[model samples]
Target: MSEGVSIFAVGDPAGAQLNAAIRRTLFVLGEERSEVWNGVLQAANALRWRRMTQPQPRQFQTQQPLIDDIVRQAKRLRNLVSDGALLDLIAEAAVAVGETDSPAGAVLLQSIEEVGTDGCVVVASKAAARAGLASWLDEIGATVLVPSELDTVASTAETSYVVAPPSFMPSSVVTAPMTPEVTFVMPAWFGNRSLPSSAFGGHAEGQIVIKSTVHTIGDTTEPETAVAEGKEVADVYFPQPVWGTRSSGEREPTSDEVEACKVLLAGGLGLWLDDGDRIRSLDPKQPEGARVGYEAVKGIVPGTYLVLRQGETERGAMYDRAVIALGARARGILATQARWKARLDERLQLIGSRRAMTELERLGVRSSGQVRAWADPRLICPQRDADFALLLDWIGEPSHPTYGNAITLRRAVYKASADLRKELESAVGRADLRALERDGILHLDLPREGFRGMIVARVLAKAPFTEIVSRHHVRVPFTDGSAQWLD
Candidate 1:
């Protein structure tokens, strides 16, 4: 127990974009490969296993099965409103839309304004009757502004925008064409000129020039330009507020009472056999190296990513053993788990020939998770080595060293064969490998109906995961990129 609590302020494990970018950039930095590393892994073992595995009823996710769950429900609400169920629900809520002019549409407008609402913008076509729309807007207590027909909206436009880096007291993105009409709510300290000329700013044709900035946190703001030229657009965003006190390692711990807390870590908090079965508590001494591993594990979940929790030291993070393999797999402890998703995304120009991807999309699989389930797809789809590689190349590199390299189909085959042969050398090993393969692994084969299908990719690494496998009943169809540890 150090005298005082270890109060290293922690922040969210950056978004996939930044994470992917850093991992990809770092790897290429050493090798001088400007090209981005793709984020997919083709799991040979998983594919092979899927082929021979028996059908077992898989559990269905009960919470929400698809990303469109909300959208679908919202659409249902529209129908319900017409059918007359909406008036009944809203009648009891004590709220009115457009009042003398409230319509269900106006009600939806209000509902969408709440924090954390999956937001959408409503644009009405010209003949859509302004009176009814205004009636709807008034019912919803919304101010109706004439939208520019020629204006466009974009999520990312890096060509000429400059944003304050993520590291700042209050980070902000700058834009051009700042004006008073644009009611943008930004941090209080932010200045009109605080934005550099490079801030990604552009005009919506003849309507107005717009720029945007997101708050560090919570709902607070500094003065902002309400309008530019003539357009009446408001800035939309949630501000994540910052709070927490800082502490140092050297803070007073020499006192007697302070040292007593240290006793709790003596095998009292049960050890976490982190990735590679390295006792996380052992390396408390090297918070630096352990920190790298710490970050890898943390990416798995919010806090358990630690080698050991609280003040416990990491004991044997050096070994190749793992703790809670499948759970970690779900949390992303596998090499695929450690990747920086942003970098691979950059290379993924979304500009390739989509014929093949389109075909898969038509079938249903859209995400890597869904793709993993397509190894042994329905149509006995022939080899997709090259196509899959192209798709993988665009997803960006993950930080875990295990992902992205030569297709490794040939090498994986040889390695798989060798491993099989060696296992057969020890009959016990053969039986075990065969049994596990017969159990199951996942695959994906679609990008479109991904809402309905799967796409396939595989992660192949040589490791005696059976030990970890024995501990958990779940099978994680992925691998830790570290052959040294997993092996």
Candidate 2:
């Protein structure tokens, strides 16, 4: 990439580094700015970037047990980090939707089914919009409306119900037998996971809507608490059961076991070992087949191990945090690219010359999809050459190592990020105005007021560079209103 590209310099993002990167990205995007800063700072202080200076013991009488313990600790750490990342994303999304209340757990089917009757106005914030809340309500026969649309349709509706954030609750409503009542659907960190498609009863027209939920004994209402109280954990995060080494004896895995592994991978779960540093595959169809051994599956708890080895099931979280982080990273990467492409379109429409537009159109580069067509790295545009070259290079095809062809979109993000360092570095350099802050005769860092003069000199320098850096950099905003950049 480039000499000082933060994205390249940073290695495989794990633990604090990955967490910090994500927090930075969200801060720059104007999503959960305060929350992200606080979270990043807290993580930094907590981790202290320590390293184990001791050398490893080469021999062990029962190496499997030691391996198992390390794995367990690793998994716990990974789960916490992944959970935090997902929650942050949800929180940021809630803010984007302008939710007046906490946006947690509002999209759960249970929450929707309780009130989603025909003609009932399901009031919700924009934060709930992306989680398929409206679609779920419609599936159960409810008239869904945003908080803003309630005023126009409130008087015309049959049964008035508001699903708004507490601040947006309609105060002028009556509370008689059938009057409007505000129901708060609090965000939850854990609950009964959505059942597999096959177990979701049937979607056939005229079939009775069977209200069924997968229940497990000793299951807590929240995942964080459940993870803390491990045995009491019940999370149905995986659509299919996880499978592992047969407890019966040494034998070849059945096709069913292999398929179960495939399902877990598809669901963003993977076998982790050696303190979450190594990933093991459940796929039995690989060149060496499935790598099922005592060491391979050691540190997993009994309930979770049974699910993997015997196909015995549980309804709780049984995933590595690294795996979750990878999935999140994949999604974040693609979303950033998509947003960048969109901004390019917006920029072109405003400033692109007629000839530039025509040339781009001739090459079928009007949109992001078309931008992918001109894949030859050496190709250059006669106009908007920088943007055209960037889109070609930035948009890439990435495939997951385990799932092969299954997760194309996720891999795209992974692959693009893999190759994005140079572009990001270039963008950062383009954005830097430190040179302007210093005298040509005596180069040095500028003071605060001098920096302001340089900034005023070129306001336009910020926009395009910011857009490009945002596609790759995580910018952590500070209390002083400045940001720390990371990849």
Candidate 3:
């Protein structure tokens, strides 16, 4: 490979000096260096910059951890700096710069040693310039220039190195050399302008760019070749499931359900058991004794039982809260209290008082007066005043006392609707209805009970019948079926 100079643009001055010292020590030892040097440089830059930017006493305190890291790295490299006096001087200078409160002058002095055999032109920052480190550097045969004197530097000359802050390093310093080698020592609070792509030879092939902040080596050649080869390998061997087949009882989801499930996943909603072990322990008799909970729809396994709230009374306090938690986006779908009352009155008128009372009695209504009130449009319906759970039991179609599958629940919803499929589509979108064809499925995204209950309500309203007969042990039917369930 052709010789190319490496540039280290560290965020902190002390960190830059430390990195230069480590790289120089590695070079002197004549051991494999670039990888180890680049790793340490990136880590040091990040830690130093973070420490400098942190609030108050934190920024002021000594970075003993960073010092420890540098010592540990040196030890890992067989303590190479101890082998030579020049390396020892560089190491001591690096430590002194890092531990000091004001490091600009110490860092600038340290940079003089990093100049190669051909020497370098140094551009001093305002702080380093005021510290009078330039005269010492110049005396050592290094051409030191202030930021204002950047234009005077002989850019056209084949210099070994050009060391400066990213802001002061001129275009001529980069493009003027046949194989330009530059090092930028960045400030703690430099403004938004980043080093140009040209500084790294437009990420050209064979160019190795080391950045301290991200700790990544941009090897332009290898990565592109790897990506191109990867595409060919993937084409030859399509991805397949690594695990065993799905359980016999699980049903594969239709394409429509998959699309709807995607939406539910995006919304972060899923079905959960209303009366799990934790919830049931809260209360045994009162329906409100326990709160409802939900799991992510994507996580529901084949055997899990999901809660289905079947109440049609839309104006309940709990129901209102649930609708509100669906977010303002659902305002168009959720009906108002007045609209609900009118719809209920019209239903009662169509059924007639006698038949309505008979249906209420069959649903287990004991009070004759309550039955009469609900049956008659003129009288206030008992449903208007009933508790949320009690209202569902009185008027809503009773769920299968044992089974909790989506197919069974959907059938119940279809039976309850006036126009069957038409009303079901109106209440729940057709796309969503198709999603309900599976067994024991529920989805929820929000943790709040209101949000959880809203998802349950939407599911109950839109559930559609499926041709699949089995419920228990039914595996989820997807193209990529696996035994492992997502938590």
Find the candidate with the highest TM-score and give its number.
3
As a whole number from 0 to 100, the lDDT of residue 96 in candidate 3 is 62
Give the per-residue lDDT of model 3 (tens digit) for 13-103. 4444443444444345453434444333333443433222221122333345555565555456445434544334344544665564433
TM-scores, each model vs. reference: 0.16, 0.21, 0.21
For each of the candidates, the C-alpha root-mean-square deviation to the true structure, in angstroms, is 26.9, 28.3, 24.2
lDDT of 1 at 337: 27
lDDT of 3: 0.33
Using lDDT as the measure, the top candidate is 3
- Model 2 agreement with the true structure over 395-419: per-residue lDDT tens digits: 3322223122223433443443333
User: In model 2, where is the ten-residue run with the lowest total lDDT?
Assistant: 1-10
Alpha-carbon lDDT of model 2: 0.27
Ranking by lDDT: 3, 2, 1
lDDT of 1: 0.23
